[model samples]
Target chain A: DQQVKQNSPSLSVQEGRISILNCDYTNSMFDYFLWYKKYPAEGPTFLISISSIKDKNEDGRFTVFLNKSAKHLSLHIVPSQPGDSAVYFCAACLYNTDKLIFGTGTRLQVFP
Target chain B: GAGVSQSPSNKVTEKGKDVELRCDPISGHTALYWYRQRLGQGLEFLIYFQGNSAPDKSGLPSDRFSAERTGESVSTLTIQRTQQEDSAVYLCASSPPGIGNQPQHFGDGTRLSIL
Candidate 1:
């Protein structure tokens, strides 16, 4: 059973535009959500994260918005650049079980 | 390396063979984790180790899979009599000691292919 799901397999956007990636989860027990970016042959790197209590968390160009009632969350990268082209994975974790439950991931291509 | 490191970036072995994948986590990090991503799939958790405590092996798929950590440093994942379905990129990660809320730092991973 897939606890987390990223519906979009891929996305393309022009540079300097805003790129949005969405993720949904079935488990309501998850208290923390995180986004990771991955390049070819490299493991995922931590991007941004949001706690369940808050609706949104932002760090520089990346922002994560969570909707607890809907069991969904999204990552928005503003002013998207070519360097932002990579696979984005959404992961959820219960505080008690720190192990991450990751989604299938969305590959974003930022074109110049 | 300043970040988590994994060795043998790529491994190709015949079916029924045994393979060992190694991981060296960041300095002073007390938490280590192992995850694998199969073709076109999400990262799957395999195991977790924290300090001197017992490791969590709940995510391990079968008895053929096992992992060992020496002290709080290097860890090895051993797959016995590997099967074709075992081909994937095995990733290792580490985090500072404390609440599980902290994000983990990952290595480049070891890609294992069973021929």
Candidate 2:
């Protein structure tokens, strides 16, 4: 079963605009959520994360919002840059385990 | 700081041949995991190791897949008598111990192709 899903396969946005990526999960036991960015032939890099107790977390230009009641989360990147072009993956950690369930990933392209 | 490292960035082997993939997690990380992504598919968990506890093999697709971690360090995943269906990018990740909420650092995965 696909416990976590990123419905959009690709997203395009102009530089300096806001880029939003959405993720959904079917599991209620997942308490921690994270976002990762990946380039071609490289591993994913940790971006931002939020715990079930928190609704929002921000780091500089990136922000993550979690809606626990709906089991949905989103990553927002403001003033998107060409360097932000890459595959973005959303992952959820089981409530009490180190295992992570990852979404299929959304490819984001920021163009000048 | 250094990140997780994996070897044999690309491997092409004939069916029925055996292959082993290696992962060297960041120093001092206590949790390690193996995942595979086939073409057009999301990441699928294969196994996990935490501290000195017994490894979790629940995610192994079949008997041909097995993994071993020496303590909290390097890990090796062996596929015995590989088949064409086993082709995929095998990714390794590591996180800190006990705190399940930590983000996992992944390695540049090994791309395995079976012909």
Candidate 3:
């Protein structure tokens, strides 16, 4: 069973615009959520993360909002650049657990 | 030069053959993990190793699949008598020696294709 799901397979947005990618989870036990960006033939790089207790976390141009009651979270990239085009994966893990559950990933294309 | 490294970026082999994929994690990192992504699917956890402790083999799909790590360094994933369904990109990740909440660094991964 898929505990974490990113229903959107692809997204496109103009450069300098805000790009939003959404993710949903079925398990309520998940306490920590993270986002990773991956380029073609490259491994995923850590982006932003949020804890279950908080509703939002921001770092520079990337922000992650979490809604515990809804079992959902999203990543927003403001002023998106062409380099932001990549597959974004959302992952979750139970408190104190190292193994992460990942989503199917959303491919975002930022064009100028 | 300090990130996780995986060898043989791409490998193509016939069915019923055995293939070994290698991963060298970041230096001094005590935690290592293996995951795979099949076509149109999410990353699936395969195994985990931490320091000198016993590795977590819960995610291993079958007896034909096995992984080994020496000390806290290089890891090898061996698929015996590989099947067509075994084709996928196997990814390796590592983290520092601390709480599991830390983010993991990953390698480029080894893409294995069974012909």
Best model per TM-score: 1
Q: How do the predictions measure up, each by TM-score?
A: 0.98, 0.97, 0.98
- Predicted complex 3: DockQ: 0.89
Scanning candidate 2 chain B in windows of ten residues, the lowest lDDT window is B95-104
RMSD values for the candidates in order, in angstroms, are: 0.8, 1.1, 0.9
The sequence of per-residue lDDT tens digits that candidate 3 reaches over residues B44-72 is 99999988989999999999999999999
Q: What is the C-alpha lDDT of each candidate?
A: 0.96, 0.93, 0.95
Candidates 1 and 3 compared by TM-score, better number: 1
Model 1: lDDT of residue A44: 98
* Chain B TM, every candidate: 0.97, 0.96, 0.97
Residues forming the 10-long window of minimal summed lDDT in candidate 1 chain B: B95-104
The sequence of per-residue lDDT tens digits that candidate 3 reaches over residues A1-112 is 9999999999999999999999999999899999999998999999999989899999999999999989999999999999999999999987667889999999999999
Off by over 4 Å in 1: none
Docking category for candidate 3? high
Per-candidate DockQ versus the true complex?
0.92, 0.78, 0.89
